[model samples]
Structures are given as C-alpha cells and as structure tokens.
Target: MPIHERSLIRPENLVTHENLVIDGVDVSGHWSTFITSRTVTDYNEAMEEEISALPGGEHINRCWQCGSCTNACTVNAINPEFNPRYWIYLIRLGMEEELLRDKEILWQCVSCNKCTYACPRDVVPEAVMKATAHWMELKGHTPKSPSTHFDESFTGSVIATGKIEEGQVMRSFFKKTGQPLNQPWLIALVRGLVLKFPITLLMRLGLSALIRPRTSGWGRTQAALNDYVSEVEARNSKALGLDGKGKH
Candidate 1:
C-alpha cells in the first residue's frame, strides 16, 4: 500500500522547489513540494518476525489498518506524530528505517487501553508499542527510555519481594532515570500526605527504606519466576537474532 501517513515520509525524502513552472503555470514553494521517489533496498525482512517474538507483539500481524488504534490513542490526541496505526503498518512491511524516524517518542505510550478496546482485530496496539520500544532498546537502535527504566525498576522490586512499596519504586525509578527526587510537585504531594496522614506516611517510608516489606516464604516462588523470566529473555533474544548476553 501507499505510505500509511505523510508524516512517516522523512523530510529529506520530500523535494520542494523554490520556483517552478509546470505547463506555463507557477507551482512554487509549498505547491512544488513533492515526495521524492526512491527504491528501498535495505529492508530488514525479519524485522516484523523479530518484533512479533516479543511480548505484546504477537498480535501485530493481525492489524488490518483499521486506524482504530490511532483514533483511540491517547498520545495521538496530544501529538499526532505518535501514530500507532502507521507504525504497525511499517513494522508489518519491514520498513525498519521508516519506523526508526519516530523512535524517540515510541515509548511515550500511556497504556490507557483505549487502542486495545477499540481494535476490531484484537491487534492490541498498546502492547505493540511496548514491544517496539523494547525491540529498539534491544537492537541498540535507541537507548533505554525513561519509561523502560521505570518499568524495570518497578518489575525488579516486585520480582525481588513479591510486592512493591510505592515509595521505594518511585525512588528507584527517579534514581535510575537520573532525576531529582525533590521536585516541587513531589514535595507538595508529600506535604499533603504528611499533613493528612503523618503516621501512615512515616510508616510507609520507614518500612520501604529500612524494614523492606516482602512476602513470607517467597524464596521458592521468586526462584521459579526468575528462571521463567530468564527463559523468556533467552527465547526473545534468539528470535531477534541476538546473543544471549543481549537479552533485556
């Protein structure tokens, strides 16, 4: 099919003549802007298969360009550049270079489930976004995004203790993201919580920092989960043509 979205075409691939005459008619500036035709020879034919191997990407091949995902996307409302439908089309076609154009904002998915609910084919576009972001990080196409860092921190805490303390998760996320924990909004939130529930707040903070709450007799369960996660990682890496060490 034709390019799914005009935004997907890079600016460099579009040519605009400052001055032009077409059949004695002036068609300069914006009127003269036209997409430059070029052959794509660097297709990563396995790109779609690799992404499909990741969690949430399994249903990517089911998408049928209904545009429901883009229409229902929360991020798309704020930034039209974040088009899930277009990205899915690119992935299905193995247009790796075109998909990389929006790599920086790919991880901004809010996971509101709007796209998932609206999808007619059970495409689960939300999961595809996560899988795409993970693929980018794994392939070294992009660094670990802040959202990825936050997810890893939260997941790590849960895997370690079979539970997560909100305070600890937040602290770990901020630290891993290299963000200051003393922001004004955070301070205000803490102040309000302390003012209303001083003892509760203190207990939570103390327990999270010092006591470290954990599930009782979780050793065996934790070990099992660790092994399962490691197995999944290895399988995903193999599917993506990566070495075991590159598993995320």
Candidate 2:
C-alpha cells in the first residue's frame, strides 16, 4: 500500500504558502501546504534482485504490502520512521534513492521477529532489515555496525577452528568494537560461571581460552568452509557491484 501518512512526509518536501488566494478564497499556512512531486530518474532496476540475493532477503518478493509487519514491529512502535513496509516497497519499486534516505535507521531493527510472525506471507521483515543493513555496509554506504562486528568475530572463530569458545568470541567482539573487557555484565557472567560451572568444565574453558584448541582433523573442513564463504562473498559483491570493494 502507498504510504499516505502525513507525518511520513519530509518537512522540506512540504511546501506552504504564507499568503495565498485561489478562486477568490484565501488558503494559507498549513491549509495551503502541498507535497512536492518529483520524478525518479534513477531507479536501480536490480535493487530487489540484489537484496534478495543476500541472506534473509530471499522472500522479499513475497511481500504484498499488507502492513502487518509494520503493525507488529517493535521499533516501528517507537519510531514510525523505521517502517519496514515502506522500505520494502521502495526496494521492490527500485527506488534506491528513497530507500537510502532511511539507511541509518535500517539497522535499528531489534530482530524481535514480531513482524515475521505477523506477516501473512512470511516476508520475515526482521531478516530483510538485517540484510538491508548488511547491503548498505557492503556497498560502503554505511560503516559496519557493532552487531556486524560481533557477527564477524564470532563467525571468524568458527571458520578458523570449527570450535566456539564463548569467552574468546566475546573478547574478539569487544576488541573489534573497541569496547573494554571489564564490562560489568561480562565480569558478572564470568564470576557466575566460575562459581557454578563444573570444576572440569571451568578448567576446560580456561585451558581453551589459553590454548585456543582446534577441532581434530578440522583442516579439510576449515578449507571447505573458507572456500564456501569466499564464493558467497564474491557472488554478493558481484550482485551489489562492489567492484572488489566488498568487505569479507
């Protein structure tokens, strides 16, 4: 559905005449306000296809503008400008410029999954938001978000060793995001783990943190995973026309 919400209109796009007369009647101020009309000369016809090519955006075409996703969105409830329905509409229509206008708020999605559950067509608006934010970063329209940094750190650990050490991932994430390791929550978590975790388990965790052990016979699997990840990255980069500028 076309967004006709007056609040969604940009203030600069709304023109108002302070003093105006039409047909022997006076219409001024808000009464004389009108939205500006402009032609979109640069529609990226491949925009939808590019976004769909990314993870979590595969079902973007299934969206029928039902508005259910927006209605159920947690962030939308707080910030109406964070409208998934509107962004999806713009993407489908290849309105790249219009979509970029809201690029900053795209990553604010909390991934509550309410929109996905409410979506009758399973559009998975939350995933679309993630994919869109990732698309922005890959295209260099925006910097990598803190969440993306965490994701990369976590994924890198797994791809390298095929083992997930919670503490290591946390430390890597904090380092990538320039956060201190002395976070209160992290300290509390460590304390709790030390207090309650089994003696053997705690020892293993500590040893692993120091040794950073790799899964046995993981070399072949690690190579395979690296190749798969490289393939996916290359494909996504080509789709977005990153021209070799895409971040891994």
Give the winner by TM-score: 1
What is each predicted model's overall lDDT from 0 to 1?
0.90, 0.87
Clashes (backbone N, CA, C under 3 Å), per candidate, total 0, 0
My TM-score estimates for the predictions, one after another, are 0.86, 0.79
Summed over model 1, clashes come to 0
> In lDDT terms, which candidate is top?
1
Predicted candidate 2 versus true structure: per-residue lDDT over 1-248, tens digit per residue: 23367776777887878888899888777756777897889999998998998989999999999999999989999998999999999999999899998877889998889999999998889999988999988877888888888889989999899888887997788788898868799899878877887797778877987898679889999999999998888888887887566364
Candidate 2 lDDT at 151 equals 84
Model 2 RMSD, rounded to 1 decimal: 4.2
lDDT score for candidate 2 against the true structure: 0.87
After superposition, the stretches of candidate 1 with alpha carbons farther than 4 Å from their true spots are 1-35, 244-248
User: Tens-digit lDDT track for model 1 on 148-238?
Assistant: 9889898898889989888788888988989986889989988898999999888777876987889989899899999998888888788
